[model samples]
Target: MDKRGSRRKSAARKDGASRAAADEPQSRVKFWMRRLVIWGGALAVLVALFVGLAVVFAARSMPGYYQLKATQTAQTIVVRARDGTEIVELGPSYGKWLTSDEIPQVMKDAMISVEDRRYYSHFGIDPYGLVRAVYTAATGDRRVSATSTITQQLARNVFLNNNRSLDRKLREAVLAMALEAKFSKEQILELYLNKVYFGGGAYGVDSASRKFFSHPATELSTAEAAIIAGLVKAPSRYSPTADVNAAVGRASVVLRLMKEQGRIPADATVDPSAVKLKEEAGQNSVRYFTDWALPQLDLLLPETFEPIEVWTTLDVGMQRAATASIKSNTPDGAQGALVSMDRDGAVLALIGGTDYIQTNYNRATDARRQPGSSWKLFVYLAALEAGYTPDDRVVDTPVSINGWSPRNSSGRNVGEIDLRTAFAYSINTVAAQLGNEVGFGTVASMARRFGITTEINTYPSMVLGTNEVRLIDMTRAFAAVSAGGNSVEPYGILKVETTDGDLLYEHERNTRSTQLVPDYVAAGITDLLQTAVATGTGRAADIGRPVAGKTGTTSSNKDGYFVGFSSGITTGVWMGRDDNVRVGGLQGGTAPARAFAAYMRYAVKDRPVEQFDTDLQLPEWQLEPDDEYMLGDPEDYYFIDEQGNLIEPGTSDAPREDPFGDEFDRTLEGDRPRQPVPGQRPPQQPQQPPQPQQPPRGVDGAPQAIGDDFLNEATGARRDQRP
Candidate 1:
């Protein structure tokens, strides 16, 4: 071969060696490719075989799609106040069923936008979303859970226990596919909307819409729908009541997703800041009544777990006012409760605590505390029954009975005051003396008759309200007074009826309105209580109209109370520390009275004003005037002038003689005493006017009464009218 032939041959051999070197890796690649195909096929077979077995077994044992009936069976139990305002819901499931077409299209779009964008296109599961979820999680992304389609969630909610296990997931996936195949998209979406719980005890979009907006699902605004749609991811965390800002943030995300996915137009109107989620009444102050009514359900409806609507006697306006007044006026960390009822003892409003979310201990119905001078009502009522009159004078001096000495609130004794005056000042020493005078046992029996069920110790201190009693019972006692001595039991539920109008229970009108305390006894106590409000310690509770109640401040001020009632309702307010920590300078006339006044200001806004029937019939002894004060010197005459002013015979306007004796002479002199009024008896001669009162001293070692003595507590003084 030539030299050129030799170079070409060498190049060919080098090229052929390079080709062989490349063929070695290519041959090994084919070998491994064959092995990869064989193993990959086997693994795919195993996975398919496992999935097939899971599908077959899950299909055979698949839980029935019985959640529809379950949700239907466990329909929400709605509770309404007397005026038909929704107060709370009672039941495990609180959702209203809706048909496929009834659900709003916008609500459906919002859910699909956030939950599964491909909800309409996918069969059951979204492999793309699942893969994305896995990739993001594997890449240390925050999204770790598997993405569930609407149909999948419906399947899980219907038949699965929400366990995050392979077996459960397989079953959920199989059921999801089955549901998608079995039901229309509208049906699946309807089930999802009607079954998923939005927090605050709301299940389904309809109930959620109503719960948050006080309207039906069809009336949901776009913003509200977005907010509720976000709740599906984390019901508790996204609840507006739990974390409003976080819920609003979640709703923003949902809104953005909807806009981006074209479910809603970018230019579509959405009010992210305009969302107004109502506070859940079930979790608010109204919870006090709902919590109480739960136990009563067993007695109200034992035959069925089906939903029953309880029509409570709660006044929504009064309830809100009470909660607001307590929170605003009460000292921080101090607690308060209020219960208002009609004369018939129908609870108009009840506030268990300042805020139910903080502490649910219902002080109104459950808490027992000393009512200080409020107990004096029973003492005085008993005194009235013991033939003692409001005009019966009692010296408010320090007194000790059986080693128990009660001191006046002022720590200063005001001597020789009437029972009305003593009660007006809530004079402790005088009340103790009255209790001693009228037997403590008598006072206790009177209180029991008026609706106090608590065992009262017949000690002198009980006269100052040392015994503990519930606000409800106290309200009941006052209710008897407001009702003119008719005994009443405080009741919340007016009637309980099934949703289908079957009567479970009805507050019977024929229920006896028995007289526990005598009608006169109630009138007497009510008379004194009104004066207490008008001129004394309970003055803070005055609403510028006729109202009666008492102020009670326990020793060391551990509790304060102002229980007031008008002709229509009796309301009791309690303010104190939950732990019995003394509230410094706190008194029943301060916070409790102010709150009572504030509550009553609203409670009676729509009601007509009426006066308390004091029934002021003068005792027979006072029917006629005393001769010493009226008829003593008949030589002088008196008459009334045209302005209704009493004309004294000796005054400059009258003749300086006995007008009746010289009537003829005065008529001739043209200074005739005003012609005797036809309907009025001739005025008797007036005697020397009485002297200024002096505090009664040790007269016969007992409080002394002067002639024609009758004290008036209404003005915290003596009454010349002597009624």
Candidate 2:
């Protein structure tokens, strides 16, 4: 009985120990669970605090975000002729900027339809859109849709750097949510419109409008608005300026989206006629001008603090006319240039070549071609300074210069002719002879003074334009003559200003020199050149107005030129093959002169009738006895001045004695008669003794006694002496 009781007690102890061990494990599990719950609650509180702080801080920084969102850099350039007419209009250089008011309703609807149909109804993150995007991404081979809301796009544009990473995406999400809370849906839409790029260097709606249609943003039609809105997805691929068909196709997609979203009424139809899509014309032309103007801007306002608006002196109508005339007149293989400037040297119109689309070589301002007889004006000016009149006698005979025989174009001498006729006919022989007599160095000096920025050869042939010159410089030189010899510097921009209307700088028309030629002399030269258009070689340049010009046809007819001026404008035209090959049967009088006339007809159609200033008048001139005859060897003839007075022989000092005076006659009598030497072989006259002569032969080869007897008996000499 005692043994049974002990076994029972041991069993009781074992059962009690097993129960205590099981309870200890349960107690340890409860303690760990309680600690875990406390830690989890603390972590939840910290996460909530961090999110709240981030949201508050972002809200506080909203103003800075808005400011950053609003700021943009834009590059815009406009080119105008001297008359304030636009040649080209370039849109901004950077991303576009548009105001909310300027965004068309159709454009707004189109963006919402294609990008985010439920943008207004959704919060920053749309669960339904996310699900749809995921489903589309999973089912389709390509990701064709996006779930990013308008607020997200704004957030990306404003605050996020472009990094495709999870951290960035998370930050974008957070910022987007914060932005949605800070700004209204309408504000987000406005920011989106103002910040998008529409391609072709156009940034916002305003720039796009001007780029495609040459109109303002506020004036966009529904079709145009739709086209621009569609470009947001892929600017370069869908740009109307780059690919019209693609742009039109994208626009159609946007229209369908609009219909699907009910942004357009069910019955409303998109009219194909409303789009009227055509390839944008003149945009490339404007870009060409902008490229040209940028370098000029940098040079003109190197230290400018603010953005500048360059108001050029270009006449759009005249520029178009010039461009069209060059294209129409120039042959297919040939290139040409046309430059027109006001009398004050302001550039009115400039056509660089047949097509700027093909090449950017600005022939008008860059090319240096032989001016041919166009340079005779400089030679004549030198003669005028030396005292030669337009009517002074010269023989257009074959002349040899350093083994080079300078011959007239016709290869036949026209015999004795006046300087005016010689210049009108572009007689090379006569011009060379005159150049030799006047000294080529003097002619070159005068040319430089008149703004010819080309190297001139100091040879007799230089008088026939052996040097190359630019069209712009030629136009400017002629403009100086039109301005009564006042030196004029060519200018395009008159002022530059910011879009906000702040004047950054202004250009003043500056005259470099006024002493190049006497006003009266310039006027007289202009009068003589008028005959070239009215009744001479340049008659083809006549345009029912008072025109004065000169024609130049170079050797082999390789280059043709016509440079002219009206009362208030000067223009120069050049036609030639870039390879310097001879144009088949082309002449300055035929092609270039006609182009000038055609352009001037349209350019001056609406301009007022104005004559060259009559205030600058030349003094009365009388022909000298020596000036009336071309007797001596061609090289022996001296250059006469405007008064038909010979520069006193052997004296370098500017001649003070008039060649027309009685004393000037005594200076001519010592060596030879005022008549042509007999037999084309000059007969040598007997030299008189230093003392008074006894009996002498008359200038006409008649024998007579000396003093009063010889003077009284020389009947032919007395008659010839009459002025």
TM per candidate comes to 0.54, 0.53
Stretches off by above 4 angstroms in model 2 are 1-74, 78-87, 91-294, 302-307, 511-513, 608-723
Candidate 1 lDDT over 234-272, as tens digits, reads: 886677766677788999999999989988899987876
Model 1, residue 396: distance off in Å is 1.3
Q: What are the runs in model 1 whose C-alpha is more than 4 Å off? A: 1-75, 94-282, 618-723
Decoy 1 TM-score against native: 0.54
Candidate 2 yields a Cα-based lDDT of: 0.72
Q: How big is the RMSD of model 1?
A: 23.6
For residues 1-723, could you state the per-residue lDDT of candidate 2 as single tens digits? 889999999999999999999999898999898888899889999986886677667777766546856565444655555455555555554434555666777778877888788888886777798887788888884855777777777777666654577887777777777777888787778877776667666766777777777776677776677788888788766866555677788888888788777888766766533565435434333333344445677666644333445787777777778878988998769998888888777777777778764555677888899888888888888887677666556777778988878877777897776667777778888888878888999999989998988787787778988799998888888888887778888877778777688776688757355767877678667766776777678989999888888998889989999999885789999999888999986788888999999998987788787665523344545332332242323222233556755443334565443323575355454323423222122223444324322234557876432333223223335434554
